[model samples]
Target: MVDVYLFSGFLGSGKTSLLLNVISQIKESGRKPAVFMNEFGSLSIDSDAVENGVPLKEVLDGCICCTGSEQTEAQIQSLLEENKDIDVILIETTGAAHPVEALDAIYSPIFADQLNIRGIITVVDSKLWLDRSRLSPQIRALYMEQIRHAHLLLANKSDLLTESEMATVSMELANYNEAAPVVQTIGAKIAFSYIEKVLHSTKEKSDTSIISGKGLPLSSKLITFTESVSRDDFEEWVKSLPETVYRMKGYVPLEGSINPHLFQYAYGMVSWLPEYVKMTPRLVIIGEGIDSIKYE
Candidate 1:
């Protein structure tokens, strides 16, 4: 049986970073592993971060928990058929995906018997979790469910918190998920030994509680802008966005630049990748109250 490892988390929780690390360790052990990435929006920049040698497959523009289930299953079946020699598979789900729905998709009659679930690891942003007051009730519930159903919970970005804050975050996460052990790490840098033990151990299977009903309602908005933006203007606009806006990503040509720059804004934090030409330049902003954000 091929072992399937699923990694889940909220936006900017470092799922890709953790997946890359896990892939490297699996490769070192002489096991053949394949990667499956699910993106919430159409344009994806995460798949490019994977190492050159790892086999990568991507599902874009939808959440794997809902309309993307059939597509996800198809991808898995195809992956197995083409790479029959692979010993393991790694699936990195979108931040908004509910693990229960993903669990159901993976355990369908088509794959339940052929694949053994090695583990479901959910990465949580310690700082984000600490300051979730602005999040909608539905979003909060979704986030809690992701942590509750995981086989392991990683409270990443620990360096952002003080010692007292770290303890508080740990305690709250413990309250949310007593079933899964919480591991703290800086920059999602967790040792493979701990991960290996969790994946290979003979612990009891996770409870598939099916807590998410009617799937997740689309509570966020996705806005796109095609106009070339000024770097200073863009930065200022991003800084002025309301707290309701959670994540923004896209490529846009900056003033006085020949190539477009990739911009990512997560919870008021902004990062710009080196200028490069990739796809049509446009921005996708996802969050509540997106209309309130003025992009001049």
Candidate 2:
């Protein structure tokens, strides 16, 4: 039977970073890892970050807990059928997705016998969590629900917080989720061995109260650049983004660079990494009412 681990986290919480860490560790340990990634946008960006040759499947433009659930199952089924040697399947859910409903979708009887449901591993952005009150009620509730249902909680981005802030966030998360072990991490880094041990030892079942109906009023817009843009201009554009914008990521062609840079923005933080190959210059902006934001 293949072991499956679900990655649950709010938008910009570093789920993809943690997924990369786990994949590397699994590969080093001589275990084959496959990825099932869900993106809320029309284009699949993070899937590009997965190492080449690893079996990957994507559910784009929908949440796996809702509209994409059927496709998720089918993709997982296809992944398993195509890769018999895979020891583990790392499912990185859309950041906005609810863990409980996602679990409900994966616990289908169709693959029940073929897979082992390891548990939900949640990555919480410590800073945004501290500022969660600023978010809309529904988004805040969804964020909390993600943490409440985690089997293993990762307090990611702890480096950005002060000692006192980390202490407060850790305490609150502990109170919210007493069943799972909360580990503070930088860049979502954690030893895969520790993750395996904690998961194997945990016996507590997830909360069964799955939130039904439509999710938040979140949406994603795909923007493609026909030509390279100056770094200063791009940064200016990013600064102009409204507070409603939650996350933005994609490959961007920058002036003077031979290849497109991997750009990521979350909760007002921006990062740019150089890429070796030229990729389609596209960006996916995810937020509430983002369709009005135009890029000329």
Tell me each candidate's RMSD, in Å, in order.
16.2, 16.7
At residue 144, give the lDDT of candidate 1: 80
Clash pairs, candidate 2, are: none
- Whole-model lDDT per candidate: 0.72, 0.80
Best by lDDT: 2
In angstroms, give how far residue 222 of model 1 lies from its true place: 38
Model 1 lDDT tens row, 109-152: 33444566666888999998988877899998888878876767
The lDDT, on a scale of 0 to 1, for candidate 2 is 0.80
TM per candidate comes to 0.67, 0.69
For residues 1-296, could you state the per-residue lDDT of candidate 2 as single tens digits? 68888899998999999999999999999999999999999998999999998999999999998899889889988999999999999999998898756765565444545666666789999999899999999999999989976778999999999999999999999988777789999999999999888776643222221111112233344566788999999999999989977667678889999988988776899999998977767776655445456676
Q: Residue 127 error for model 1, in Å?
A: 0.3
Model 2, residue 232: distance off in Å is: 68
